[model samples]
Target: MIPTNLVVHQQSKVLELTYENGSTYCLPFELLRVLSPSAEVQGHGPGQETLQTGKRDVLITSLEPVGHYALKPTFSDGHDSGLFTWDYLYKLCENQEQLWLTHLEKLAAAGLDRDAPMTKQGHSCGSH
Candidate 1:
């Protein structure tokens, strides 16, 4: 399930992943950052997940491989904790559109904007 090739296009702000199955996925840096499977973003458990905002322009600065199963992407915003596992990455590619829409819904439900920072009184902001 590991990607055969992982290309980070900084200028385009996207990550192009090619799998062994000959499938390719073009994932935007923003999307990856927002949906990062890190404790910072996903929190420690269900219902504690944090919604990431204002990441529409984020970019991956570097991608370092972790063993032979995952990648650690350091984003321009300084977020590098999320380790994208092979299977996890494949899941992201498989459910791209639906996940995006769900994220959008979460944003709207919180009266937040994809292009705006989460600055409401008690909300945890992801701005860096």
Candidate 2:
């Protein structure tokens, strides 16, 4: 389902989406950045996904519509490859809690802090 309205609340750091069915989801900027669907984050194959860290302060610098199906967001962290499709976004809204929990679990398993900076090797830097 497509969103009827989308509002970016800079103060709250959330992207609020309102659907035709009157359902609204407030997605945090951090969540959106860490969970980006871009290949840079998701990788091109299974087990190659890059775990994101230090995104608690990431911001949506700009957002643009992509054709009639998706949105392209340029994050303050310089991530702009993820094209958030309508269906994908709806799913994110529906499954936010579970997805977030899973992400946390993965981070814990990797012994990485959500607010820790990533190193050049795409892993969290313990020095920081």
> lDDT: which candidate is best?
2
lDDT of 2 by residue, 1-128 (tens): 99999999988999999999889999998888888998888877789889999999888999999999999999998889899999989989999999999999999999999999976654333421
lDDT of 2 at 128: 18
lDDT of 1 by residue, 1-128 (tens): 87888888888888999988899999989999999998878977788877888888888888999998899999888889999999989999999999999999998997878888745334354544
**Clash number for every model?**
0, 0
- TM-score: which candidate is best? 2
Residue 118 of model 2, lDDT score: 72
Cα lDDT computed for each candidate against the true fold: 0.87, 0.90
Q: What are the clashing pairs of model 2?
A: none
With a 3 Å backbone cut-off (N, CA, C), the pairs that clash in candidate 1 are: none
lDDT of 1: 0.87
Worst 10 residues of 1 by lDDT: 119-128
